[model samples]
Target: MLSKASTARVVIDLDVPGPAISRHLYGHFAEHLGRCIYGGFYVGEDSELPNEGGIRLDVVEALRALAIPNLRWPGGCFADEYHWQDGIGPKADRPSMVNTHWGNVEENNHFGTHEFLALCELLGAEPYVNGNVGSGTVREMSEWVEYLTRDGDSPMVRLRKANGRDEPWRVPFWGIGNEAWGCGGNQRAEAYADLARQYATFLKDHGDNKLYKIAAGAGDDDLRWTEALLKAVSCLGCGREPKNIFQAISFHYYTVAGTWEHKGSATDFGLDDYYRTIAKAQDIERVIRAHSSLMDAYDPERKIGLVLDEWGTWWDVEPGTNPGFLYQQNAMRDALVASVHFDVFHRHAERLVMANIAQTVNVLQAMLLTDADSGALVRTPTYHVFEMNKGHHDAVSVPVHVIERPEAYAVDDHAMELVSASASVKDGRGLVSLSNLDPEAGLEVILDLRGVEVQGVVGRLLTASSPQAHNTPASLGAVAPVELPVNPASRGTLAVTLPPHSFATVTLTL
Candidate 1:
């Protein structure tokens, strides 16, 4: 933990570069829950808002600014119940179903495969489709892949052509299921692993499109589930080369300030609750390290990948909203949570391939919030964090060593570090992201940029007067970024003072 005035020394080794930080790590997720789909991204063909093919043009424009690399679609849990066939064809003639998983709301099937793909096209992002394993057949799963990626004549290809698409769309990522231990299906890990193998076996590649099949994996702290999956999939002692049954394994972890039944409020949190939230957010590093170790045990060469498909802060929905809608306010704390996660993510880039923040809009820790009545869009504080860290995408990860730091604060009996940061280099320039977790005090960070010639450094800072400060429709620029000055320290070091509960990114001209 850091005091009101503390200096932390961090060393960045530019020469000892780690793995390339996959651009897919900065991905977004759009599900069929609440306004995230209906009033969030899609406003119908007749809305007053600027739209292209019924997709919100402003949302597209805002996300494109972040250079969002990939998008996971059709679920958090909805993918299991979604039948791809029902969502395709004409919109008016499409059937409706009750969304039993979320709020028991009626799904009118307006946004489907074609609409989602169109949205991805508009945003210039790759689509990662999650298949239905809880209620659909293997043949159904196989044909959906064929319908989306297969070229030339086939049963599903003909059906896709008849439905209006003349050519196949390129889809690279496919998920077998979601949360098999809970909402996806209450199956054991071994049972789900066998099913994953069977389902992935038929996900055929067509033309130039190859699929990277990801199996729905363990929940947070479910090490036995991960070990069970490794045992079911590993072919080490079979005396033959191992086959890629699934390209990656996915797990989910959400930072919550309280228990599941009583998750703390999004905006009205006290100082103790805030510190507890930070401690919970930092715990993801332990989860990632544990999973990575198990993966290394099964495949020493690191052939398989680990995907944190679902992550972010989960708070009690704003008062008066539907509990299942999961609508919450974004604050500076959410931004710090994101910054801490990215710093941890940069450290594990070797095995961590991709991650999608729990949602993109109108849900828990959303980037954008939409007003259904007025069709107004508001960018959240979390959005600015993604924008500031965009330079990290696909850049070589440079190890950040904390030579000296503040004493860890005790939050709910857990040690919480106040200063967190990560560095990456690309195209002869370097980007260093820094975050101060203190809510009331500022900290001076000294950067020891090693193995690189220092030329110049420019910085952008994101913070507000209060930790609870956020952006609303009336005040969209409330918590945005401003120019931050980087000063020349003694020797070849660079110095910058980060305000409490703030995030900053410095560009190094090397």
Candidate 2:
């Protein structure tokens, strides 16, 4: 319990470098489901909107602006049902198939391996391809890798050159399967581990391209899955020397408003719903800690990393949208969620290698929302959070000690702090991100920089009058970021006040 008059003291040690934040930690995900690919990214060159080779220019620019390090593609569940052969060679000759996992919509195979690699090149992001392991065979998965990375004279290499790219594309990350416990065949942990080992064995290196294979890990806090998979992989040698086959294990956790079937409304929620969502989002820290602890039992050397491949808030679909589309609006609540997640990731930078928020556009927690009919694109509140926190990317984590913490907001025993924060330093500059989740009460954070020297400070704040405040094509800039005033410190300590339900990033020159 914290006294109401007590101000939070954040002590940042500037000299210590806790961990080097992986640039890949700030990653994004794009799936073939809904308009995430067709209208959200690819609008075709002939469309009235500005595009390059059928890909929307505005979307590309927005992603580039974020300096997104890596992007996972092809599916969430759709990856399992997808076949690589149907989406390559010629556009006219490519086959069309019904996306059974999604809305039963027909996929024309317009965007395939080539398109995805090209898009990654455009965005300067590494392409993390999810191989089809549920229905496709091992040969299909192996050849897809060969087709993309084989620079030598091979049959697949010839096809790639015939398709237009003479030079091979580098694919650094690959997923054996997604959601193996559910949409990815529903196999138990042992069975999925067997499948992962087999697929990883065949996913070879072509030329200078080395694949970092990620096995499908537990969902939420299922430590059994982690234990079973790691135990199974450890015994791969079978009475001989043991071998760890995976470079990383992936965990998927989505923050749903309530139950899966009746997830509450996206923009029509009250304070209870808002606090419940924050509590749900904070549960991710528990998931990461528990999973990492399980990994430690088998991977004590810490060679293997935890990849949060699919994460973000999943609310009920917007009204009138296709039920399977999974489209939802981003609000001020989402900004707080992003801030909290980013802080958690920074705090756990040692074991957490990468995290890709689910569905980057017009889909779950999307940074950019697109309107096909009106040709309108609006950056959401989450986008501002990402942009503001970009300074922390690749920065060394600074040890932050929070004293006199704010009391938790409790609702039925589920509690979270009113203020969340993380700090980092890079290039002689200190960066700190703080989120005040209180809906009505502002928090004044006192920075204890007794031994550290700071020349100047600048800040940016993102907040709105209502938690449901969001950006729409009709009402753009409704919940954007604004510069915050940073007063000079007194007695060798800096102070900044955060408004209720706001996320702020302060940068200090050292």
Candidate 3:
């Protein structure tokens, strides 16, 4: 490490190709909790906000720009208790229910299956539906699948026709349950593993729409759930060919700077708090690698994929907001968290096929925040990070070896790398996403481009005056990406300086 300037050497090996970074890895999640489903994605037809079929147009347009691959809906803990039938009928006639897991608020069942699918269609994203396993029966789960994907005449088909849709919607991902350890069902790992097998058995595929059944696995460092599920489903001694009970296993990890009892405030925090959050965010790489190692012991062929369905920073709600809403502001700190996460996700793309950030809008680390009364929309700092890294979608991953780097940012004993990076190539073009995790010092990075011919380089940077800097409806552009000048390659290497608490992406003309 250079004392004058925190310097690093990142080797982007173009010849040795890695896994295809699934566009699905850049997915977002929305639940029925708080404003995420209601005001977040769907306003009523009579709303003053411009909408189609009660889905917000501005939000759809903003997300469409990001080219988000898939959207997980009606969940977190809400899926286990949600009764699909009650939400399917006419809006005026649909039954109202208490969202017990979130706030004790009554939901009018306005945004049902059709509404969610419509939102996905508008955004050009696939739909991932989390099914109810805690309180729903096998028949109920089976019928829901048939209703959404069956083509010909049947009970579910007839029911779908009566509700006004003739053709089936293509739903590629289906979650068997969510977080069975706690809010989902408080069941032991062994118990939930058996239940997952039963539920997965009934989730049949219809027409040409194949369902990638994902079983709810574990959270945090709990590896027993994954082992239990793998053990229960393993057909090692059956003499016949091994059959996967589920297509994928899921896990959830959230970066809380403080404990769950008192997650630090979103907009108010010290530099130590910022570094602590970054340290926590960096833990995701370890978690993913750990989970991937476990999955390998069971399925060496790599037939199963790991779905990080819920992630992102979980700060305390903004003042004067309902605690159950989980509504928090997004800051430059959150942007770095996202940037570091993507770098880690790229490294594990071979086993990690898809990941969805906790909640999409007006929820924890949301991309956009909406004003229900004024119809105002503001894109958060996290949104810019996603937009800036859009070039990596469906792109082939490449090795980013940080041989020379700055010292880790240490908060007391916990230390996190000061620099994080990932690279990819697609169609003769290449992209390098870099983040300087240090809050007080800039880092000079030299891209050691190898095994590929480089032509030119352009860059854009997202940063703030301070780590706590955030966006509001009043100051929407307080934190956004700005053009960064980059000199052409010098001896097969591209050099750029990253500002503190910032994320930058350099596009390479290869």
Put the candidates in lDDT order, highest first: 1, 3, 2
When 1 and 2 are scored with lDDT, the better candidate is 1
Please report the TM-score between candidate 1 and the true structure.
Answer: 0.98
Q: Which segments of model 1 are wrong by more than 4 Å?
A: 1-5, 235-241
What does candidate 2's lDDT look like per residue over 252-351, in tens digits?
9999878999999889999889998998888789889998877776777677889999999999999999988899999999989999999999989999
Candidates in order: C-alpha RMSD to true structure: 1.7, 2.2, 1.6
**70-158 in candidate 3: lDDT tens per residue?**
99989989999999999897889999999998888999998999999989999999999999999988899999999999999999999
TM-score of each: 0.98, 0.97, 0.97
Write one digit per residue (lDDT tens) for candidate 1, span 10-86: 99998888999999999899999878989889988998888988999999999999999999989879999999999
Poorly placed runs, candidate 2 (over 4 Å) = 1-6, 235-244
Model 1: lDDT of residue 308:
94
